[model samples]
Target: MSRHGTAARLSFYYAALFTAVGAHMPFWPLWLKDKGLGATDIGLIMAATYLTKIMVGPAAGHLVDRHGDRRHPMSLLAAGATLVWLLFSLVDGFGPILAVTVLAVGLWSGIFPLGESLAMMETQRHRLDYGRVRLWGSLTFIASAIATGSLLTRQPSAVMVWVVAAALGLTALACWCLPTSVAAGRGKAPATPLWPLLKHPVFLAFLATTSVGTASHTVYYAFATIHWQAAGIDGDTIGLLWAEGVIAEVVLFAFSGWVVGKLGPGRLLIIATCAGMVRWLGLGMFTAIPALAAFQLLHAATFGCAHLGAMHFIARAVPPTLSARAQGMLSAVAMGAAPGLMSPLAGRLYESLGSSAFFVMTGLSLVGAGLALFLARRWDGGTIV
Candidate 1:
């Protein structure tokens, strides 16, 4: 009944969600490397995680809409993901590993957007500060990323998957306690057509910008930890580099309400795209700490701003009944399938051009900025839905 209690529980769930991400996002490739996979193989594996969204995310969203509650499915997915992740310890071959990865990803991919849809509804109903509560997740992300990096300095590669499993275990426990006040469209007319949003010129413009622009970061997401290690950076500093970027993201989330009020989602997205261009290009050319720090600081814009704009855009433009499905679509395009589609190409470029692969990503980010800008100009001034 108390909003504060609900927010704390939500915050804990975020902490668990990102702890899994923080551990896996930066270190999974290293784990793959230790498994005797090449950069290309590693890229393909990472791509699979994103691609699984197409298979699972939208359907999960529809289920949530049908049931009118997110917590039950989230708990089931987290539990399944935990069991599947344990398979990593047993699988040695690439094919087996990919199979397990797909199972894990497809089961778990809908959790975040569903959690977000729940959080957004609470924010509207209870006037909860979405960014402030969300900041706890970022904090843990920093903690887990830094702690896991430190551990891997001496720990075995198996530690990576173990940490991921542990995090998922915690996520399953947290899901039971998440807010369940969200209303479902259950007992209403048949579900809303997602095609209407797809057909909207403005929404399509937004989707195009996100899908194409973020493709550039495929190199960084898939290989930055590996690249920096090859350049002789230690695990501690690599963790710090990851932390530095997320710290900026935390700052952005802390002030997200103000930022959204001032710039709106479209403008924020444009900024994110432009910053992404600078960050990826800089990473390709410079490996020095000062430069790396600068580029990492830009994570605020690249990831932080982009994400803030996305959630806000959904809140403002989409009807509440369609929130989960809309978020699933956003997740699939921006964070899921696009990265899935681009990572292999990034691997090819990385193998052929090494650091020069960043240049290609830079080009993609620029294209995203152009589309985002066009969308911003064409967008109607919208009130929050």
Candidate 2:
């Protein structure tokens, strides 16, 4: 295929994948509440989804590396995800819903990391810019989130399942169009086990920094709308708030190439970690303040910059063949395990400590910033590749 054709196909895949997340993330918890789940029950169910991803992502990564055919596993999993969602639409209780979520998310979550591996592989093959191509996903995420949020305001919570299912089905279709050449040929290089990598100081630092930085967002993800509602913000206003953060994220992605070039990955990480400290503090304490408009803008750095830094770190730190594994490991650590473990804690802390949970997150972000600074010294002084 021509380079332009390849890029177009990959961009479509990203749009579909991110749209799937946009459908689920903002609305899923609300749907659970609609089903009569309490706050703690909602948090537990969501945590279960992340827990499944942590357990399943590495195994899926290993399979992709072993079989050397990204298409087969990815397609099968996407199909399974679609089926799981279809099943979920029928279930009414916490037990059935949680069971389906675990099954569906365990398979559904693997699609992105594997798709990313394919995108990077194509970028390497065609000398295309990975950031430029990858940014499309961020754009799609914002667009879809806004559209879905608006739809929810007019429609029932049941619509969320249909939106999610449709997105996953489209994702599977996009996966089918991925370049067959890159899809085949599982390299014979022995799989580097995750344990040894976890033991490495640099990797541990990366894990810790990412865990703390991302954990800061857990409260916002799990309870932002609820908190805002309690504070007298209307549902529509809460949706706007969430959309605004994503819009800022989209803008950051649009400029990611220049941003990465000017600041470098390590410095960007430090900035993101610092921004996390400010963001959680703002949300935890000053969310009711009109000045929150200014603080919410920091989402660009907190999520956008942090994710960009992590992607670059994985790209630079690991070889191309192991890129899938590295991304998988990062997702499992940062998104899966860290959030899975920290989210419930954040919920509990919010119950007893109230907004002081932000102070805890603030301290964690400071630690992450310090670690990023150390990594800057370690990685900046040396050749990253």
Candidate 3:
């Protein structure tokens, strides 16, 4: 393929992947409710997906790195995920549904880290802008979430399976379009255990900071729609709020090159961590206020800043050959395990303490900020490779 063709195909792939997540993240809980699962059950089911990702994600990454063929694995996983979602559409009861959700999520989560590894590999090879390509994913996510929310307002929850299945099928098709052979050497290094990576203090600090910051968003992800509904916001308004956050993210992603030049990765991490502290605090306390409409705009920094900082840091802190593994570890730890462990805890806290649960999230954000500060100090002398 021509260089432009390759980039266009990859961008489309990412767009489809993010659209799938956009459909799944905000609406899956509602689907669970439609299947007769209560809040606790929904939380457990969601937690199960995360738990499986923590285990499966690293393995998938290791496979991609060792085999040096992301496309095939990605395609297989996407197809399996689509099948699981289709199965979900068939089952009605909680027991069967939870079983299906676990399988589906476990398989589904494998696609992204692998796909991201491929994108970063391409970026490194071609000197392309990762942010520019990734921004489309954010844009598609925002668009899909709003469109899906509108669809759900008129359609029953059963349509979620169809929506997700279509997205997953597109993901599989995209993966098939990706190159099959590794661009770099495929020879295996002795399987370096993830333990050594974890032992690096700066890396650990990076992990902690990003993980805690991400975990702070769990309540909003898991319950923000329900919360807004209770506060008398209509479904369409809730959809707008969700889209507002991603719209800000898309804008941030567009300007990430400038942001990276100005702030550097270290300072960006600190900014993201600090903004996250405020974001969660705002969600906890001022969500009911009209002013929060403006505060939600900070999602650009809360998610976008933190994510870009982490990816850039990973590129700097680890070797190119290990880039996929590094990202997988972050996904396993930060996105997968931390939230997996915390979601149930947050659910309990939300039930007991209600909106005050934001206090817990706020405290986690403070911890993340502290970790970011520590990483900034530790890696200050190092240069990005």
Candidate 4:
């Protein structure tokens, strides 16, 4: 495929997948509230998706790794996600909604690691820029977040069900066209056990700060929209707030190569952790538009840089053959266990402390920053050939 063809294909898939995410992340809590679930209930429900990642995400990544034909697993999982979300439009109760969310997220979560593994492979082979390609996802996220936020003004929150369902359906279709299939060594056993890899000091450190840094976002993810609403921000403005943050993230992804070349993944992670501390502290202490807007721009450092740092860590530390497995472990720890554990706590705290819950996140970021700084100082960059 031509370079443009490959980039375009990858960009399309990202757009499709994140279209649902853009809306789902910012407004799903609102939808849940519309359904009559309280803060604690919403927390548990959010946690359930992360919990699914813990139970099933690693195995799913293993399945993708075991087969060389990743396209099938990727497509099927995307299809399953679509099916689950479509069923959501029909359900009304907390139990059914919770059950559906857990199942849908499990199916949905695998697609990201699978896509990342594919992207990293292409980056190695084709000299395509990983950060540049990924920025497309961020760009689409801005569009999705803003569009969905606007829709909420004229349409009922229930309309969100259809939006999510449509996006997943599109995502499943996009999966079929994902970059030409990587060489699938059918029926081959994985050469090494996953546990030994985790025992490496560098790998262990990467996981720790990544998990903690990511966990710190739970307060924002779970409550920011609600908090903004209570503070008299309109829906469209809230959407813009989410979009503005992702725009910062997009900028980081677009220029990550230059940044990574200058500082390497260790420094990048340190920057991410420190930025997170400042961002969350500011978020907790202020609700005024200007303050929130300024802090939202820090999403570049909080989510964008942290993610690039983790990706760079994996690329450097793990064998190329084990990319999918590495992504799974990263997802399970940061995306699965930490967020799953912290999300519910954020909800409990949000209920009791109001916006003050962000203070706890400030502490989380501080710990992550301290740990990442130590790792950066001690661990020289190492790559497995």
**Against the unseen true structure, what C-alpha lDDT does each candidate score?**
0.86, 0.78, 0.80, 0.86
lDDT of 1 by residue, 1-385 (tens): 6989988898999999999989989999988888989888988998998998875767877777766878898999999999999999999878998999999888778787788888888887888778888988999999999999999999997889899999999999998889785564553432666778778888888778888866777999888988899899999999999999999999988988898889998999999999988898899999998899989999999888888888888888888778888788877887788989999888888888999999998899889999999989988756323
TM-score of candidate 2 on Cα atoms, chains taken together: 0.92
Q: Model 4: clashing residue pairs? A: 68-184
lDDT of 2: 0.78
Q: Write the per-residue lDDT of candidate 2 for residues 36-56, one digit (tens) a residue.
A: 987777878878877776867
How many residue pairs clash (N, CA or C atoms closer than 3 angstroms) in each of the candidate models, in the order given?
A: 1, 1, 0, 1
Off by over 4 Å in 4: 181-187
**lDDT (10s digit) by residue, model 3, range 1-385:** 6678778988988898988988888878888877787777767777777777787878987887787778999999999998888998678776887788778988888887888778877866776677888998888888888888899889997898899999999988888888654635556752445567768787888888888888888887887777776787766777778888889988888888889778777788788878877877888786564656777888998888888888777766766567778888888988899898888887777777777887788888788888889988888635333
Per-prediction TM-score, please? 0.97, 0.92, 0.94, 0.97
* Model 4 C-alpha lDDT per residue in residues 1-385, reported as the tens digit of each score: 7778888888888888889899899999999998989898898888887877875667766876676566678889999988888777788878999988988888988788888877777776778788998898898899999999999989999999889988988899988998755533434766546776778777788889999998999989988999999999999999999999999999888898898889888988999999988999999999999999999999999998898998888888777657788888888888999999988998899999998999999999899998898879767788633
Candidate 2, residue 80: Cα displacement in angstroms equals 1.1
Between candidates 3 and 4, the one scoring higher on TM-score is: 4
Worst 10 residues of 4 by lDDT: 180-189
Pairs of residues clashing in candidate 1: 68-184
Clashing pairs in 3: none
